[model samples]
Target: MAYENVEVIKRLFQRLFRDEFPNLAPAERQAFEAQLEGRIEGLLRGAAGDGKPTDFAGIIGLGPEGVQPFEDINYPRIKPDFDDSVIPTQLHAVAELYYIWQHEQMKIFQVIDVLRRLFQLGQLRIQRGPGARGLYILEKWKPLRYSRRDRMIAYRRAFNYGTTPAPAGAVVNNNFHFQLVAFMSAFAQYFRDLMISEVIKGGVALSERPFGSAATIQRLGLDLRYALDRASYGNILALTTETGQYLREILELLDTPDIKRSFDANTKWDVVEQVSQRHLGGQAELSQRAKMAESGRRALEYIAANDFSTTLDISVFHAEGKALAQHAEAWIAAYRMTAEGRRFPGVERQLRWALGVGERTARQRLTA
Candidate 1:
C-alpha cells in the first residue's frame, strides 16, 4: 500500500478536485479528469519504457535497482570562505525576514485588509480601473505565481537548503525548515479562502450596477484569471511552505545572540532597519517591508476587534491544513526517492526543475 499506488493516486486526485472545485460543472470536471488521466498514462509510459510493467513503485525508480550511489553526479561548488563574510555572518537572518516580506508582496496583511474593508463597508467595489485591461482589482489578492526555479532560488537565498548555490552564508536546518514550510502553506490556504469569500460576497451583486461589467475585466490575463478562479489550488501549498520557512528562519536568526548583538537597537524594528540597509538595500523609511509592517499591524488590530466567526470556519481550515501537510510529505518522499536512484530519464529532470534545482551548467546531483 505505497502512497503512490495508481489507485491511491486516483482517489486522492478525485477527492482533491471534488473538495476544492465544487463549483465546476459535471462535464467540466470529467474533462479535467480525462486530462489528468492522460498525464498519468504519459508518466507511466515514461517511467516504464521498453514495455516494462509500470507500477507506481517502478515509475519512481524503486525497482530491483533499489538505492545506488550517484557517483557520476557532479555537486555544486562551495566557496571556501563564503560563510566568513561579514554581511552573511551578521545579516543572513534579517535578510531572510526582508525576503519573506518582499517576495510574498505582504500577502497576509493585504488579505486581512481586503477582508476588513469588505466587512466594514458592508460591500466593496472591485471594478476595473485604468490599465491595459484593468488594474487594482480584488482578484489581485491571490498569491503571486512563481516558477519552480524561482522558488528554489528563494530557498537558497533564505536557507540554502538545496542543490543550488545559496548565498555565501546560507545555512541549513532541515527539520525546522520543513515545519515552517508546512505551517505557512496551510495559513496561505486559510487566508486565500477568506479573501476569495470576501471578494465574492462584496462583488457578485455589483455586476448589475451601472459600471458593474467592468468588474469582469481580465486585467491579470487568462493565466492569472485561471489561477484566481481555482483559488490557486495547484501551487498554494508550495507558496505557503516557502513563506512559512522563511518566516521561521527569520525569527530563529533574530533570536540568536550574534545577530542581536550586531545591532545597537532599542527595539526589533531598529534591528530590521539595520539589516535592511546593510544587506537588502534601500532606506527603511521607503522600503516595502516598512509599509507592510505598518499596514499589517493595523490589519491585525482590525481582525482582533472584529467578529469573523461566520467567515472563518476552523474546521475547514483544519482540513485544508491536513491536506497541505500530507501533500508536502508525499512530495518530499518523492523527491528523496528520485534523488536516491529511482530515477528515469526525464523523471529526475522534471523533479529537479519543479524543485528549482539542477538547472546549472553542470548537472547537479542530489544529496541526502
Candidate 2:
C-alpha cells in the first residue's frame, strides 16, 4: 500500500509543474519538462524505500485522494485547537509521509539520521540560529527578500517566520528549481510545526494567553501547562534510542543551542545509551541502590534472549526517548516563564497559525 502511493505522489508532482513555464521557447520548454520529470522521479525514488507517502499522509488527512486508510478509532480528548493543519498543508503531508515511512521500516536512530542525508542529496543548506531552531535554505531557488538600511544591503524578513527566499547567490531561472524549493520550504515548515505542536499537545500553551476570550485564558493556561514535567521526561526517554552521533549532529544542525549547552557530549551519549540498555524489554523494578545494577541485568537478559543477528524490538522505547527530548526542550522553556509569572510573549496569532485551529470552541478528538 505504501509503495503504491509512490507513483501517486510522482503523478501529483508531474501535474503541479507541467507546462507551468510558459515563457520559455518551444525547444527550451521541452528540455525543461524533460529535466523536471527526471528530477521528480529522483525525489520519489529517494523516498521509495519506506512505504507509500499516502500511509503517513493518513495521519494528517485523506490526502489529495479522498480515501480514509484507518478504521474507526478514538483519540484522546484534546482542546479544540488541535487539528491536522497544525502543520502547513504541503509541508505536513511531505514530512508525515517521509518520517512515518522511514520510522515504520528502520531503527529510530537510522530514521533520525536520514534527515541529514536528505539535505545533502537534495542540495539544501541549514543555517543554525542562536535558539533551538535553524534555517533551511534551498540555495538554488530564488533571491531572498531584501531591504536598504543606511545605504547598506539588509535582508528583510530573513527568517520570514520559518519561510524565506534563497540567499544573494541563487538560480531562479528554471521552473523545476522553483518547485523543488517549494517542496523543501514546506518540509522545513513541517519540521518546526511538529516540534511545536508536540510540545503543545503535551500541554504547555505556547502563547502566554490563548486568544478568544479572557475568561478562558486562565483555565486554558492551567490546562496547557498541566503536563510540563511529564512531557519533559517523556521526550527525553523517547530520544534515548538515537545514537550519540545522531543526536549530536541533529542538535548542531538544527541550532538547538539551548539543548547543546544543557549537557556535555559525554553525558548526553551516556544518558541515551544507558536508557537504551536499561529499558530494552520493559522497565526494571525501580530500587534506590540497584538502578545501575538493574540496568546491567536487563542488558544481559536481552542479549541472552535474542540471537546475535536479530534486532531487538525497541521501537516503543526509542519513540519515548525521542518524545522526551523534544517535549522537554519546549516544556522547560514554558515552565520557567510560568514559574516566574512571565507570559509567553503574546504569540496568540502565531499559536493560532501553528495549531490550525480557530478560536476556542468545543473539544475534538483524533486517533493515534
Candidate 3:
C-alpha cells in the first residue's frame, strides 16, 4: 500500500520507447542523463510551497528551504516490484486504448491535432534522412482522453484497425523497438485503472461493478465515486503519461509532412510558454529523483521506493520531459536540411530511411 505511488512511476517509464533513444553519442546521452537528475530533484520536491497545506499538491517534498523532513514524518517503507511480466501487459493495454482514441479523435481536420499531440510527446521517431547527416523525428503524444462513451466505443473498436487494408507502399515500415524496463514500468502503474480496481474490490468483498472517479455521473451509470489515495492517483497519472509518450513515438515514425508543417506553423505561442513546456513537463513529479542513472530520475526512484507517490512523480516527469525533448529535436531537425535532401552527416545517405517520413521525401532529405 505504501509503495503504490512509486509503483505508478516505475510502470509509466517501463511503457516508453527507450530503444530508439540510444541514438545520441554515448557521451551526449550520458550528459542527457545527468541533466535528467537535476530535473528529478525539482520534480519530486513537488509544488506544495511555503506555508501551505501539505496535502494540496500531488506529493509533499523537501521545499526550496532545502531540508529533508525524514525526522518529522514517519516514512512508509515498502519495497516496490518492477517485474518483467508488466511490460507486455502495459503494451497491450495502451495499444488497445490508442486504437480506441484514434477511432474517436481522428477527424479529417483533427488528424493534425492527433499528430501534433504525438510529435510533442517525443515517444516515437520519424525518418527524415540518413546517418550523422540524416535526421529523425521524435514521436511525442498527448495523454488519451477517456469518457464513458469513448471507453465503450474503444471496447467495440479494439486495437485492430481492420477497416481497410492499405497497399504495402502506403504504410510506413517501422520496427518500433521499446526498452523492456520502460515497457513494464508503465504497466505496473497504469493498467490498475482497467484491472486492479477489480482486484481491490475482490480483496474488500465489494461488488464486481467497481466505482471509479466519475461514480456519481450518470454516464457510467454509477452511484458514487470512491475515495482514492497515493496509489490510485499515481497509477492513472503514470499510465496516462506512458501512453502519451508512446503516441508521440508512433507519430514520429510517420512521415506526415503536413503535420510537421502545422507544428511549425503555430509559431505564435511565445518561447517561454513553448520551450518551457517542451523541456520541463512532468517535472513536478520527476525532479525529486536522486542523481542516479545519469539523471536523478531512476536514481531518485532507487531511494524513494517506500514513498509511492514520489516515485510515481519522478517517473511521470521523466516521461513528459523526454517526449517534449524528442519532439522538439525531431521538428528542428526538419529545418536542418538542404535541397538535395541531405543533412550534415554521411550517415543520412547510408541509412536511406524516413522513419516517420514518406519514403521519397525521406530520400530527398537524406540525399540533400
lDDT of 1 at 135: 19
- TM-score of each candidate? 0.23, 0.16, 0.17
Which lDDT tens digits does candidate 3 get at residues 123-171? 3243343210112222222234443343433223322223333333332
**Per-residue lDDT of model 1, residues 226-247, tens digit only:** 2222222233345545555544
Per-candidate RMSD, Å: 23.6, 26.6, 26.9
Identify the candidate with maximal TM-score.
Answer: 1
Better of 1 and 2 by TM-score: 1
Error of 3 at 367 (Å): 69
The lDDT values for all models are 0.37, 0.31, 0.31
Error of 1 at 272 (Å): 2.7
Instruction: Using TM-score, rank the candidates from best to worst.
Output: 1, 3, 2
Candidate 2 per-residue lDDT over residues 168-260, each given as its tens digit: 553221121122222222222333454576587784333232222322222222222222111222112222222223334543543344323
Highest lDDT model number: 1
Show where candidate 1 strays beyond 4 Å. 1-214, 217-225, 228-236, 255-261, 279-287, 290-368
